[model samples]
Target: MEMVVLENEPEVLMENISNKDNRDTSAAPGLKLYRCVAVSFGLLCILQIALNISLRPPLNHTNCISNSEDMTTNLTEERDELKRKLDDLKSHQNVLKSERDELKRTLNDFAHRSNNGWLYFSHSFYYISPIKKTWHDSRNDCLQREADLVIINSKEEQEFIQRWVKNLMWIGLSKRDGIWKWVDGTRLTQSLWCAGEPNNHKDSGEECGEIRGCGHDHGWNDEKCSNSNFWICEKKMAL
Candidate 1:
């Protein structure tokens, strides 16, 4: 049917050819040639549109699958990275567990100690401001507790007693003639005095020694031994 129609349009085709011939050599094509070119482009457009309509479903599916694969690949890489970090953290946890176990074992090695008349850190001292019963009373009190007047020898020994013995106590660091001596035969290393310090009221009848430093009996000064004071004794036990 289409071929029969094309054959019947033979005069129209001859008219188109005649219009192309009338176009000048140096000028653009005539209207009839332009119309023919336009009709050919329209047919090409129609064919392309038909092909796209037929293939739309399958082509869309292919694109969707490609995009899904790319996303899955990215997620897989991220998951692998997370797994590696989890493994590293587990190893660190194991190390900490071992260290904690070792510390617990070490703590078990020591035993607890008990306190008795053996004289723990608890003790007190008394001092005589007036010429009370002579220096004799001070010496006797020190002996009764298995301790002597506080003698500050080394910093270590001084620190040990000073921690708790806050009250004024008779210290062995007394001036003999004019020289300071500790009952333990050790000399005082560091000495502290009060604001108007160590006036040595001994000449005013103050004898023996009294504690005059800032912290307490731990820091001592020369006073008359005739002054009475209580003494401290220190003894330790092993665990």
Candidate 2:
């Protein structure tokens, strides 16, 4: 490189440079820059076009748009199914509510019915034909009527029944060989006996129980279940 010192006349130095360089020097540089910009822009556009063609078929517009649409459709179908399940649950709840209301109404009606007192009750009694009965035959008859031996409650209750129970009426109470029990599965604490009754076979062939011969207390006697007598049908009525 050559170095020039500008200590002499500045006008002389300027004049020399002015004559050597062209007056339209700005145009040349501007044109070169424009050409470089155009070449760079053309190369960028060509590269962009080549990249677009190199992409896969699925990256093309149709497949991409269809993929988005399919995703949306699947979401909509799942949402619809969930909504249907929710609706079914609501319907079942309504049905249960209706049934509950119906039950409440029925219960209310029964409550009113009970307030008007028309109740009936029946007690099963062990009965026997005043004639001879082989234990089996008596059991069969009781089964037919859906009833069993009569269980006399209190002493008063026994007397109450004994007055009407003529001849020898079999009581629900009995002794199995030797164990004494009432027909209602209760133990016998009290007994209505004739003076010396239940001497345990003092009477002939007396293996069961019977209510016979009225004492002032309407005592009971263990007798053979044979001998015709009008039986008392023990039942209750609430009015």
By lDDT, the best candidate is 2
Name the runs in model 1 displaced over 4 angstroms: 1-135, 144-146, 186-189, 212-218, 234-239
Per-prediction TM-score:
0.36, 0.40
Across 72-152, the per-residue lDDT of candidate 2 in tens digits comes to: 999999999999999999999999999899878756644553464322123223233455454435544555544555566
lDDT of 1 at 14: 88
- Model 2, runs deviating above 4 Å: 1-137, 155-163, 182-187, 200-203, 226-239
Q: Pairs clashing in candidate 2?
A: 125-149, 125-150, 126-149, 126-150, 130-226, 130-227, 131-226, 131-227
Give the clash count for each candidate. 11, 8
